[model samples]
Target: MESVKIQNRDMAWHIAANIQFPPNFDAAMTWATIIAVHPFGSCKEQTSGNVYGKALAEQGFVVIAYDASFQGESGGEPRWIEDPTQRVEDISHVIDYAVTLPYVDADRIGVIGICGGGGYVLNATLTEKRIKAVVAITPVNIGRLFREGFSNYDPLGALAAMAAQRTKEARGGELQVNELLPASPGAAKVAGLTERDVFEATDYYKTPRGQQPGGWTRMLFSHAQNTLGWDAFAFAEILMTQPMMVVIGQKVGAFGAYRDGMEIYGRSTASKDRQLVSLEDWSHYDLYDKPEPVDLALEKLAPFFKKHLNEATGQ
Candidate 1:
C-alpha cells in the first residue's frame, strides 16, 4: 500500500488516497482497478483502506481508498462538510486520476462504497459509466436520513433550524458543529440511547476498535442543507445500469442502511445483474470491521468484481 494525492477535477481540493496493489502487482500488465469509498466522517485509513483495500488487493485487484475532499488528510476549508454533490463528484475525480496510471485498465474500473460512501457510489454510477461494477456495503442515503430522521425528529423542523443557522453564520454568528454520537457505548447507555446501531457505531467510532483522527464524526450543522433535498438513488431506475452488489445486515436501525440497500436494489431496474445479500445474523456496523462479517462480504464481492471487471474487457 502507498499513499497518493489525487486532485479533484471539479473542485480546488486535493484528495488524500491510499493505493493498494496486489501481492505480485506487475506494472507491465494492466489490472482492473477498484475505488474504495469510505463511510461518512471516515478517512481512507479506516475500513475503506485498512480493511477492504488491503483485502481486495490481496484478491488480485488494484484498489484505492480515499478520504472525501473536505475531510481527512484532504485539502479543504471548513472541514467535515458532507456535501452530497461534491461527494458524488469525488468518485469521478478519482477515476480521472486512476485512468492516467499506466497500471490501471481504464475500461475495467469498479467501486466499493461503505455506508454513506455506498450511496455516493450509486449516485456516481448514474452518470459515470466508466464504472462497470459496484458494491454497496451497508449503504445509507443521507438525504433520506435527513428527511426521515435518526431519532425520529421532524425533517422540516430540522431543515428550518439549519436554514436559520446558516443565516446566523452569514451574519457573523458562531459556526456550529455537532458530535455524531456519545463518547462511548457506556456513555450512550447512560444517555438513554438503546438503539443497537447507535451503540455499535459508538463502539466502533468512539473507541479504539475503530476511532481515528479524521473519523471523529463531526458535522457542520448548517452544511447539512446539502443533504436535506438530495437523494442518492434519484433516477437510479433509469440511470443505474451497471452490475451491482448490495450487501446489508438484517438488523435495521435508525441509520437505515438496510432500508437504503433494499430500496436501491429495487429501484435500480436498469441494472441487468444487481444482487442484494443480507447477512441474517449481522448488524450494520458488524460489516465495517468484524472479521467474520467482512469475510463473508468479501467472498461475494471478490468474485463479483472479478467476473464483471474481466467480462467488461471480454477476457
Candidate 2:
C-alpha cells in the first residue's frame, strides 16, 4: 500500500499512485508492472481497480494504480472532461514510468482498464510495444456511446453536440456547461440506464463509498470524441499484436461491450493467448464491484496476471 506522486510532462501534473507487491516477492518471476485506469471522472483510489490491484499484488507483482488525468489528484483544467485521445496518452505515460522502476522487467509490463478506462487501454495497446498484455473490464466504447444512445440510435449525435459546443468555446474563450451525466433515469438512455444509472452513480459518487468531489468531469472535452468513423479503431477494426484479456458480464444486455471486445479479438494477430471470459449473472456495472457479478470477473483476473507474470511467458 505504498503511494507516491508521479509527475506528468504538462503543468507538472502529478498523479497519485500506489504500488504493492507480495511481502516475500521473488525476483525470479521478472519484474511485472500493472498500470490500472479507472472509469471516467473517477480517481484511482475510488475504483474496482484498487481492490483488484491489491489482489494481484498478493500474488507477487507490483500493481500501479493511479488517478486518471484531470481526475482525483491528477492535474488538468475544467476538470472531469472526457478526452479519448489524452486518455490513451495517459496509458502510455504510466507505462513510461513503470519501466523506470528498478524491479520492473520493462519487458513484462501490462495494463488494466476499468469501465471507460477499459476502452482506453484497448486503444492504447495498438501503438505501444512495451505493454505485452492487457485486460479490459466492462469497457465503454465512447465512440459508440456518442454515435448511438442506449437504444442504439445515433449516439454519435451526442458527441457532435459536444464538438459543436467546443467550437464555440474555442473562439469565444467561454463555454456553456452541461450536466456530467443524464438529468435522471428516463426513456432516453439506451441501456434502460436512466433510472439505474442515476440511482447507482449517486450511490458511488455522492456517498462516501466512492465519493471524491474533484472526480467529476465535464459533459464534453476540448478535443475529439473517439467515435467509430474517426476512431483509431472503430468498434470493430483496431488490431493489436499483443496478448489481451477481455472480461464481460452477463447479467444484462452487453452487446456493445462484448461487441467492441470481440471486434478487437478477431482482428488481433496475437496467437494462442487471447481470452474472453463471460460471467453468468454479470452486468456492465457489476465489474465495478457489484457483489455477485464481480466475483466472476475477479475469480479469473488474478490467475490471468499470475500465470503471465510468474510463469514462463515472455522469458
Candidate 3:
C-alpha cells in the first residue's frame, strides 16, 4: 500500500488516497484497477474502504481508496460538508489519476462503493463510461434517505428546519454540525435504534474496533442543504449502462430494510448484467467490516469485476 496525493481538476484540492498493489505486482503488467469509495463522513483509512482495498489487492487488482474532497486529509473549504454531486465527481477525478499510472489498464477500471458511497458510484457511472463494472454494498441513497425519512416518513418539517438553518448560516450564524451516530451506546438505545442498528456501527466507529483519528460523527449543516433534491437513482432506467452488482444484508433493519437496493435493481434497465445478492442474517452495518459478510461480498465482487472488465478490455 502507498499513500499519495493528486490534484483535483481545478487545482483547488489535493485528494489523498491509499493505493494498494497486489503481492509481487509487476510494473510491466497492465492490471485492472478498482476504486473503493468510502461512506459519508469517513476517509480513506476507514474500515470498509481499507478492508475492500486490501482484499481486492490480494486478488491481483490495483485498488485506490480515497478521501472525498473536503474530508479527512483531502483539501476543501467548509470541512465535513457532504455534496452528492462533488462526491460523484471525486470518483472521476480519482479515475483521472489512476489511468496515469503505467501499470493500470484504463479500460478495465471498476469501482466498489460502500454505504452512501454506493449511491454516488451509481451516479458517477451514468456518464463515466471508463468504468466497466460497479459494485454497491448495502447501498443507501443519502439524499433520499435524508429527504424522505428512512422509514418513508414525510420530511417536510425536516426540510423546513434545514432551510431555516441555511438562512441562519447566511446571516453568519455558526455552522451547525449534525451527528451521524448516537453520542453513546446508551444514547442509541434511547433513540430507539434497534440492537442491529447500533451494535456493529458503534463497535466500528465509536469504539476501538475500527476507529481512526480522521473519522468523525458530525457533518456540516450544509450537507442537508445540498442533498435536498438529489436522487442517486435519478436516471437508472436509462443512463446507467455499466454491468452492476448490489450486495445487501437480508436482516437489515434500517432504511426500510434494503428498500433502496431493491429500487436501484428495479430501475436499472440498461445494465448488460445486474445482480442483487442478499447476505443472510446480516444487518446493514455488518457489511462494513464483519468478516463473514465482507468476505462474502468480496467473493462476489472479485469474479464480477474480473469477468466484466476482462471482457471489456480483452485482458
Model 2 regions lying over 4 Å from their true place: 8-12, 25-30, 150-160, 171-174, 182-199, 221-238, 253-255, 269-271, 312-315
Whose TM-score is higher: candidate 1's or candidate 2's?
1
Query: Candidates sorted by TM-score, descending order?
Result: 1, 3, 2
Task: List the candidates' TM-scores in order.
Answer: 0.97, 0.81, 0.93
* Model 1: per-residue Cα lDDT over 46-132, one tens digit each: 898889889999999999998897799988878789889989988999999999999999999999999999999988999999999
Compared with the true structure, all predictions reach lDDT values of 0.90, 0.67, 0.83
Return the top candidate by lDDT.
1
| CA RMSD, predictions in order | 1.3, 4.1, 2.0
Question: For residue 304, what is the lDDT in candidate 1?
Answer: 96
lDDT, candidate 2, equals 0.67
Model 1, residue 245: C-alpha shift (Å): 0.5
Kindly list the per-residue Cα lDDT of model 2 for residues 157-274, writing each as its tens digit: 6557667878888898675654455333332355455444445554566556666655564444445454433353543333466677888765444335656655566666553377
Model 3 per-residue lDDT tens digits across residues 106-163? 9899999988888889888888999999999888888887776631355676667778
